[model samples]
Target: MDQDQQWLINCLNASLDPNHQVRNFAETSLQQASLQQGYGLALARVAANRELPFGIRQLAAVLLKQYIRKHWNEDEEGFEHPIVPSNEKVSIKGILLASLDDPYKKICTAISVAVSTIAHYDWPDDWPELVPFLLSLINDQAKLNAVHGALRCLALLSSDMDDMMVPKIVPALFPCLYTIVSSPQIYDKSLRCKSLSIVYNCSSMLGVMSGVYKTETTALLLPLLQPWMEQFSSILK
Candidate 1:
């Protein structure tokens, strides 16, 4: 590792130290470091590194999520957080999704939250490829952790998607969700539950959309309704 990365790892370790002074000092140093270019990407790398201690990795993941929230959008009206450099944002976004496959559940959850936060501001417009990229991961049965990570992100995003986004994502997302929820032998119960939750959230969004975009919403949901109902029945049983 480079000197900067090593120093970051040290700060992450110190932040978790029981000593108040040491932890405070480390946090101050980290806050200052957040202004530097590549800081977010560094935290991402540290979080994804399996060689690091679990606590350190988890802290890095959590900090990275906060970093994205604070610095991502420069144009938001009232936010005072400094804008993350555009080049750094591109670099960070590129690798951020891959970190979803981290074996540690906490790390994966943190990365998923980070992805959802980024998607909130960037999806479809700035991040045109987000849904397709996530769909690829969800469909990749070879990597269960990636699938879990993708599902976590989708679950979070589903709850808050607007009408335009609902139609764009639901048709693609429901089929994949159905695949996971229906295959009890292939997916764990928790993953199936998560898929069901996304379904619920998406269905709620569709219910709201039905009033305004009735024809489009109906066409989007019609084919999948029966199969989804069957799966829901199976789960209830």
Candidate 2:
């Protein structure tokens, strides 16, 4: 079993090798071994490992995403086959979240995307605990990757949220979101813009909800252009 797992990591790592033969060999190995259980965790483990070469890590992350999208889901038969086991999920989340503090921008982007994918499957019902962790990170200014990854997942969650839950979610969500979008003092311009984008998209979704949420919609829309508008007229202000 240990040999099989190490074999999978080797295949993923080979993609970074300069030799075309080595790279092709790795690809074929993955294609063959991907059918086995525990493959998804192996890929994610490689991606989250800081000791690995960056290029190799990215290949692992991409494979992990592909593996996840193909296999893990709310199945038709309602059977449960978690390719990433329960204990592993917690450990993986911690690694991915901590990877947000990585200095490499590309690594940060990759980790954020992986986190977003995990949130898609785990949140709404399966995992409510992640919400608080992400929210706390969003409020933190010192760590850009943590903020970016957290906000990315939150935006993703809101995008697919049920209309029925809008009332319950929007009131709590908007204020934290507002704090991100409204603050010019935050060092990251990208975070500022992303926060506004979330507000813009969520506002539209909220707008279509029941009459009771009309005030919430109005509250969100009022600041729709403020962040970008401030940027366009920076000298005047």
Q: Please report the TM-score between candidate 1 and the true structure.
A: 0.95
List pairs with backbone clashes in candidate 2.
Answer: none
After superposition on all CA atoms, what RMSD does each candidate show versus the true structure? Answer: 1.4, 4.3
True-structure RMSD for candidate 1: 1.4
Candidate achieving the largest lDDT = 1
Pairs in steric clash, model 1: none
**Off by more than 4 A, model 2:** 1-9, 18-20, 74-84, 211-237
Please, what are the lDDT tens digits per residue for candidate 2 over residues 1-237?
378766766777776678999989878888767766667667777777778788878877777666666556645234234455666667667777777666666776777777777766776576767667777888777776778777776666667666654555655566677676667777467777777676666666676763666775567546544644664476256
After the best TM-score superposition of candidate 2, give how far the Cα of residue 21 lies from its true spot, in angstroms: 3.5
TM-score of 2: 0.76
